[model samples]
Target: PLTVLQGYLEMMQEQVLEGATREKALHTMREQTQRMEGLVKQLLTLSRIEAAPALAMNDRIDVPMMLRVVEREAQTLSQEKQTLIFTVDEQLKVLGNEEQLRSAISNLVYNAVNHTSPGTEIRVSWQRTPQGALFSVEDNGPGIAP
Candidate 1:
C-alpha cells in the first residue's frame, strides 16, 4: 500500500510538471499519502504489540472507560457513516495494561470496519466470563466463510 501510494505521488508530481490542475493533483496526492501513512502506522503498532510480552497486571483499570475510548476512536473513524454501538456491564473493573487492551479492541474494530459495508452496524460489547473479560466486535456484515 505504501509503495502504491508512493507511485501515485510520483505520477501526480509528473502530472503537475506537465501543467495538470494543481488543486486536483494535490488533493489526490494528500489523500493517498494519508491513507498510506495510516496503514503503515497501524501495521507498526500491531507488530510491536505482537513482539512484546503480555503486560503484567500491576494496577486496576476501569474496564468500561477503556472500552469507551476504543469505541470513541472507532466512531471517529466511521465519521457517522456507520454506527458503533458499545455495551458494557456496569462497574466493570480489571487488572491489566489498559493501553494494550485498548489496542487489541481497536484492532478488532478496525477489522470489523474493513469487512463491513457502509451504513452497517458494528457492535462492541464486553462482559465478564467465567475466567476473564470478554470483548467482542459484532457486525451485521458478511461473516467469514468456514
Candidate 2:
C-alpha cells in the first residue's frame, strides 16, 4: 500500500494526471496512508504483546462503538469500489484490548476490501453470541485457493 501511495504521489508531483484523475489519486493516497497507520499500530501492538503477554488482554471494551469507528474507516478505504454493510448490536461489549480489538476488526475489513473485486458487498457485523460477542467480516468475493 505504501508503494502504491508513493507512486500516486510521484504522479501528482509530476502533474502527470489532472482534474478528476488527480482527485481520485489524492483520495487513494489518503486511503493508503490510513491503512499504513493501522498496519503500524498492529505491529506496535504485537511487539508489546511479545514483551509482556498478560498486559495485552483484560480491558472492558465497547465492541459496538469500535465497530462504528471501523465502519467509518472502511468507507475511506473502500472508495466506492465496494459496498460496506455493518450490522452492529449497540449493546454488545467484551473483554479485550481496545487497540488489539480495533486492529483485528480493521484487518478483517481491510482484507475483504483488498481481496474482493469492485462492486462486491462486504459485510461487518457484531452480534450477541451464546459464548459472547461475535464479530465477523464477510464478502461475496472469490474464495482463496486451498
Candidate 3:
C-alpha cells in the first residue's frame, strides 16, 4: 500500500508539472496520503502490541469500564453508522495488565467494525466464568463460512 501511495504521489507530481488541473491532482494526492497514513498507523499499533508481553500482572481492571472503552472506540471506527452495545455484569473485575486487556478487546471490536456493514450492530458482552472472565463481540454480519 505504501508503494502504491508513493507511485500515486509521483504520478500526481508529474501531472502537476505537466500543467494538469491542480484541483484534481491535489485531491487525489491528499486521499492517497491519508490512506497511506492510516495503514502506517495500523502497522505501528500492531507492532507495539506484539512487542509487549502477552500476559502481565498489574492493576485490577473493571470489566465494565473496559467494555465501555471498547464500545466507544468501536463506535468511533464505525463512523456513527454502526452502534456498539455492551453488556457486563456488575462488580466484574479482572487481575491483569490493563493495557494488554484493552488492546485485546479493542482489536476484537475493531475487527467487528471492519467486517460488518454500516448500520450493523455490534454486541459486546462479558461474563464471569469459573476460571476467568470471557469477553466476546458479536456482530449481526456475515458469519464465518462453513
Candidate 4:
C-alpha cells in the first residue's frame, strides 16, 4: 500500500505537475488517495480488534439485516460499475459485535469492488447451517489461478 501511494505521488508530481494529462492525473490521484484511506481505516479497525481482547461480543446481530446495510453502503462506494447481490436466509442470526461484523462485511465488499474490474458482479450471501450460519463473498473477477 505504501508502495502504491508513493508511486501515485510520483506520478502526480512528474505527470500532473508537468502539465501532461493534468485532469486525468489529478483524478487518478484522488481515487488512489481515497482507496488508500479506506485501506488505512480497515487496518486500524483490525489493529483495534486484535489489541483489545475484550470486545463486547454479546450483541445478537441479525445477519440478513446486516447484509442489507452492507449492500446499501457498498452500492454507494461501488462507483456504479459493479452489481451487488444478496442471498440471505431470513432467519440467520449470530451473537457478535455488530460494528465488527459490519466492518468485516464492508471490508469484503470494498475489496471486491476495488479488486474487480468494471461491470463485475459481487454477491454477499448468508445462509443457515446445521451448526450455525455461513456467510460468503463471491465476485466475478478474474479469480486467482491455481
Best by the TM-score measure: 4
**Which is the better candidate, 1 or 2, if ranked by TM-score?**
1
The window of 10 residues in a row where model 3 has the poorest summed lDDT is: 15-24
Pitting candidate 1 against candidate 3, the one with the higher lDDT is 1
Ranking by TM-score: 4, 1, 3, 2
lDDT of each: 0.77, 0.82, 0.76, 0.79
TM-score of every candidate:
0.71, 0.64, 0.69, 0.78
- Which residue pairs in model 2 clash with each other? none
**Model 1 TM-score (2 dp):** 0.71
Name the regions of candidate 3 deviating beyond 4 angstroms: 16-32, 49-56, 140-146
lDDT of 4 by residue, 1-146 (tens): 56665777787667536455666556777777887887788789889989987878889998788788777888888878898888989887889888888888777777787788888788888988787788888997766468
Error of 2 at 89 (Å): 0.7
**Preferred candidate (lDDT higher): 1 or 2:** 2
RMSD of each: 3.6, 5.6, 4.0, 3.3
Deviation in angstroms for 5 in model 1?
Answer: 3.1
Pairwise TM-score winner, candidates 2 and 4: 4
- Give per-candidate clash totals: 0, 0, 0, 0
**lDDT-based ranking:** 2, 4, 1, 3
Candidate 1 pairs with clashing backbones: none
Residue 50 of model 1 has an lDDT of 88
